[model samples]
Target: MAQVKLSAAGERFFGTNVTPRSFEQWIAFLRLELKKTQRKRITASHNLHSIYLRHNNPDMAEFYARADDCFIDGMPVRRLFELFSSNAGFNHRFTLMDNLPQFLMAAQREKWRIYYLGSTEHVAQKSLERIRREYPNLDMHLHHGYIKDNAAVVDNINKHSPDILLLGMGMPLQERWLLENFEQLEFGWVVQAGATLDYFTGEQAKPPRWLSAAGLGWLYRLAHDPRRLARRYLFEPWWLIAPIYRHWRLQRQENGTPRT
Candidate 1:
């Protein structure tokens, strides 16, 4: 199925399409589409500011562009849609944490075998325990993000052959890894879930809904892990302005308006 293109919003965010689908819509799409097409390869990449870094890295950016399904997982990117799209009413942000319960329920109902990759061994174990507590019948496997041997990792995934693969090893790396191994992965959906595993294990907590709604979730993350996220949360968002402006310029040019 073709991704419903988001209009008024630019066709591309940097180099990737700003394909905005709500949380409910995303679940529905997954259920319907995956049921219909078994060979369909779908990648769900979220947390928008990472796109700036992806933009700088051509390979990663191309993977984001090629994803069969893309959802806006960060607020700043939602705000950008509001700023740039005439039909912005449909855009909404849902983090990985916000999405997990419904997603797991659906996966359980659909009988999808899942593989969880990324995060430390402790976090991965704790996350699986929590998941099993909540979803007793969730057919899933876990592997810590520390594994460096790409071939071995691919071998393990192929051995199990999960219907869905959740890669939560954080941005660029997770996306890059997914793309690099895309050919070898015979799975339903490969999701790039940054810190979802940590959230599951209570190793990290998301900012309050208010902060996320106010587009300050990045700030909360920065406060919690300053040493790691400070540069990403502080500097990466600023990079979006250039692409947004470029989109605006293209829109104006298309409408027969003179450049300022």
Candidate 2:
């Protein structure tokens, strides 16, 4: 297996062991996999921890292995890549807010069944309606994001058998929920999409594409919700960045050396 060495929060996360393999590699992998398989799958990782290792949070560590395909989802990972090699730091692939919509559109074109599980009945129903309005041919079933009893949710999943399930609970919870119940899900994929409704329903807006590409998506997100996210951006990586930056520099040295 190919791997690229990465250091974060005094911990290390390896990459695909090839240069320039950014977020696109992930999307490419998913697009091809979805084309071939129909099995329970999840695409998730710790955003503040895995992606932003310098800004890592210990609480999120449990979700690492549980993530089917854990993407180091922050600019910190990207920055590490750029520092060590000639690769583009950011891949700008899928984020929960935007990715679900793109995938749903693709599902629509393919005439796939999509089940959305999150929010109240009214909320879930409204999301379904919004999606229908956006893509006329889209086939969507409302399992209702409301969870009075999870067994009932499991039953709906058994009955509809969705091609993809966009799970909308926040992090760790969503990931944990999928791990706990994937055995019973008849879906081909279980994507952990947090707060997708807020953005998808026009309740929030993403930044310009160029800004996202420049690893500025967090900046946009922070600008939108400063009170909620400022501390995360400011204090999360309080002490680890210096050492992490040094390790990242070491990667550059290793990459620059000529092999015998």
Predicted structure with the largest TM-score when compared to the true one: 1
Q: Local distance difference test, per candidate? A: 0.73, 0.59
TM-score against truth, every candidate: 0.87, 0.71
Best-fitting candidate, scored by lDDT: 1
Ten consecutive residues with minimal summed lDDT in candidate 2?
Answer: 7-16
Candidate 2 per-residue C-alpha lDDT over 71-90 given as tens digits, one digit per residue, 9 for 90 to 100: 54455555554454433333
User: Could you tell me the TM-score of candidate 2?
Assistant: 0.71
Q: What TM-score would candidate 1 get against the native?
A: 0.87
**Candidate 1: which stretches are off by over 4 Å?**
1-11, 38-40, 256-260
Runs in model 2 deviating more than 4 A are 1-28, 35-38, 49-62, 84-92, 120-122, 143-146, 239-260
In model 1, what is the error at residue 5, expressed in angstroms?
A: 16
Report the Cα lDDT for residue 55, model 1.
66
Per-residue lDDT of 1-260 in model 1, one digit per residue for the tens?
Answer: 44443323324444555567766666666666677656537566456556676768876767766776666787777776666655547676677776677788878977888888999999988878888899998888889999879789889988878878888888678877887788887777777777787876678867877887787877887898899887787777677677667877876776732121
Model 1 lDDT, full chain set: 0.73
